[model samples]
Target: MNFPSFGFGSPWVLLLLLALPLWWVARRRRPPSAIVFSRAGTLAESPRRGQWVPRLLFLVRNLAIAGLVIALARPRSGGRTEESLSDGIDIVIAFDLSSSMLAEDFQPENRLEVARAKIKQFITMRKNDRIGVVAFSGEALTQVPLTTDYPVVLAAVDNLQPGQLEDGTAIGTAIATAANRLRSAPGRSRVIVLLTDGVNNRGAIDPRTAAQAAGQFRIKVYTIGVGSRGLAPVPVGRGLFGLRYENRPVEIDDSLLTDVARMTGGRYFRATNAQALDEITREIDRLERTPARTHTYTRYTELFRWPLGAAVLALFMELGLLAWRAPLL
Candidate 1:
């Protein structure tokens, strides 16, 4: 399937220009039709016994010349990435686990569920990057070590849920853990994708400090605020028909999320629904590819013109025989 050069790119096709001259030469030596032979018995046999032979040899010569012409142009059957973008990336995925994530604002599935689903997709797309996972509620903890195995990293995502830690949202702690994980990474592009619903309600570390720490390590952190501005329903008590009903108002702190992203020279994304969350994930993916590099190609080709020359000689020699080289007998 792959080749350095195809055989058809040779410049033998240019030999077709000589076809006009060859025709002129054949026509010039044609016997004059007005001349009559003295003896009918001497000119009894004609020289056109096989009309197809000379034409067939001409066809073969033309085909061979065309193949040589293509081969000369060096037609490549396939190409390779001569310059690959070596943007070795090391990433950390930090998720929120506060009780507010249980709010029904996201419908059918809560905020945590939506975040996890998108994270799984994110993991699947990063086949060459080394990724780690961190789960945070009241405190931050590394749920998985940095590795290129996406399945193991995705397994850590499955372990996320509200109340996994204590019962608070320590936004800074999660980022801090991500920073620590990437502190010594040798990758040229180090990044963190932090998803949170509420502000820093618990933990000793401040979000700003974590951002600064991540910046020191040249790590870009993209902060995503999950949830919408609305009063959502919550479960309180069972009704007569075994139906539970309740309501609560949850608010997301956009300022902290925005500051975290801006401090690390990254962008902040706000997702209000599952679809928006999917879009945010796609945007992150779009922003996460390695830089493009210029690719180069060099190849060698060996072409033989002997076959085409032989065909042309055969056709012309046969034509000469029909005209004057052979006796009419």
Candidate 2:
């Protein structure tokens, strides 16, 4: 009752279209002709059998084209559906919301901006894994819970703005919050990405203590220190007159970050710029992998009859055209 085929099938069908030109050639007028023959009157007696030859040839040509079109369609028969393995992991981004994160040191965008960009790239590379979000500054906040929807996670990353917290950097609190949400996850591979510019200064919990909690939950934590060494410029001027502001050296405590990573059986990275941050995220992405399962269905429909019929019709047309145009030798 129904038939299925490839949408782009039978491009050769255009060849059968040659019939249009063959018909056109039939309608075209022939110039007046004078022929020298044994008997000129006999020419008229030969009958217009020549016209029938083209008609038969055109039919044969159309049949050939039709056969080619059918062949290209690649018709198949039968259908199947099944479910199989799908692999992925669980990921959470714990971003800093402290005021210092707003400092522009890596060129172009600031530290937070660089972190956001890297997180987005990392999400695209992840597969079969649920993800969550956590943002912290002087305090810690859960932005999103673990879910397979990477789009929602990416949107959360974009909304991370500075000065959300009043204290300072609470690396421990951020890690703790992220690990807590992932502690009871159904997926086995759980990971926390803690990004900050400074050491744990505001939270009651120390960075090491939080990392220990993460480890107890079997959560891997990758700590990242984002920013360059030495002083970076700050815009402290007003109007074209340019008032002027003080310059302060940029500071990052890599030791604490490294210790937190080691405590949780993870790695610590220092990103001085965008490229380093991107590479670090990619490296982590490669490290965590969880399995997933997916379902799929395939269908096919037999097409031999069409091509067989075409071959017969072309043979018949060719025979008919030859017989109809036969001349006396």
Candidate 3:
């Protein structure tokens, strides 16, 4: 099995290792006991025995000291697992895909392009939250389902285009579709962010009725009216060479959106530009956060016992050998 990182708990205790050399020097300098040999010739004639006892005893002494030092530097391995206390909020973004979204009044790009960029940014910020996407025009469709997998949501948002759906604003159907997705979500808080730049002109259900349904299900509905007030550049037609642009009046039903938000216990926001859209998303992010409970724990296995045991056994063996080899006095 793979083990976690290993380290010493009391590493400062390892400084005691410096004394091992000093001890060895002291042992070497000590004077050896003198032995008188009245009959040197007879002793030389007797069978010689190995003189390795003193060296063996010295090795044992050093090993005992080393083991003790290692034991002092406590060692352990592994890491703690922590559970997040903040629960994620489930969100569904209902995007407008009507032809009016192609208007270029927002600058460098059209309303749909700017909205897509801001939506991507919003998804990036809420990494822990589960998000889904719904694209609406004359009809509503679930582009992506609720999921923590952010890449799928981002991809769906990036692929949004005006001509994919029938060209009409179905604000009511969009809300109802988004609410259906959130009804079964497991998060503590469920929300739908509806973005549009036109008045509701299609679908059987009314926008207010859909908002009431969301309220009944305890889901929040934040509505955003996207576009600059007054005349904005719009693509009228394509000639022999390229597309043609003309100044047309911008039309956003902010009153209906505000009413929808009021019915669902949510807020309505007006985004005249890209920056305002970003700010509106950030505000919704702050409002959707709910408190959650979490748990955390840590486990460690100590390794000091092995070295300490070795130190004791080595010291005992050394003492026993010395006592057995000592001459009678």
Q: How many steric clashes between backbone atoms does each model show?
A: 13, 12, 0
Model 3, global lDDT:
0.86
**TM-score for candidate 1, residues paired by index:** 0.60
Please give, for residues 257-298, the per-residue lDDT of candidate 3 as tens digits. Answer: 999999998999999999899899899888888765555667
Q: Give, for candidate 3, the lowest lDDT window spanning 10 residues.
A: 33-42
Tens-digit lDDT track of model 2 for 1-329: 22343332344554554666766576565442344223335457774425445555656766766676566555445644568887867788888877677677767887778888888888878776788899998889999998878899899888988756675888878888998898998777789988888767788888888889889988999988988778865444445675343466767889898898999899999988889998899888777766766567775455656775786779777776567553222
Best by TM-score: 3
Q: How accurate is candidate 1 locally (lDDT)?
A: 0.74
Q: Which stretches of model 2 miss by more than 4 angstroms?
A: 1-82, 234-245, 292-329
| CA RMSD per model (angstroms) | 10.8, 12.8, 9.5
Write the number of the candidate with greater lDDT, choosing between 1 and 3: 3
Selected candidate, larger lDDT, 1 vs 2: 2
Error of 3 at 290 (Å): 0.8
Question: How well does candidate 1 score on lDDT at residue 184?
Answer: 91
- For each candidate, what TM-score against the reference? 0.60, 0.62, 0.65
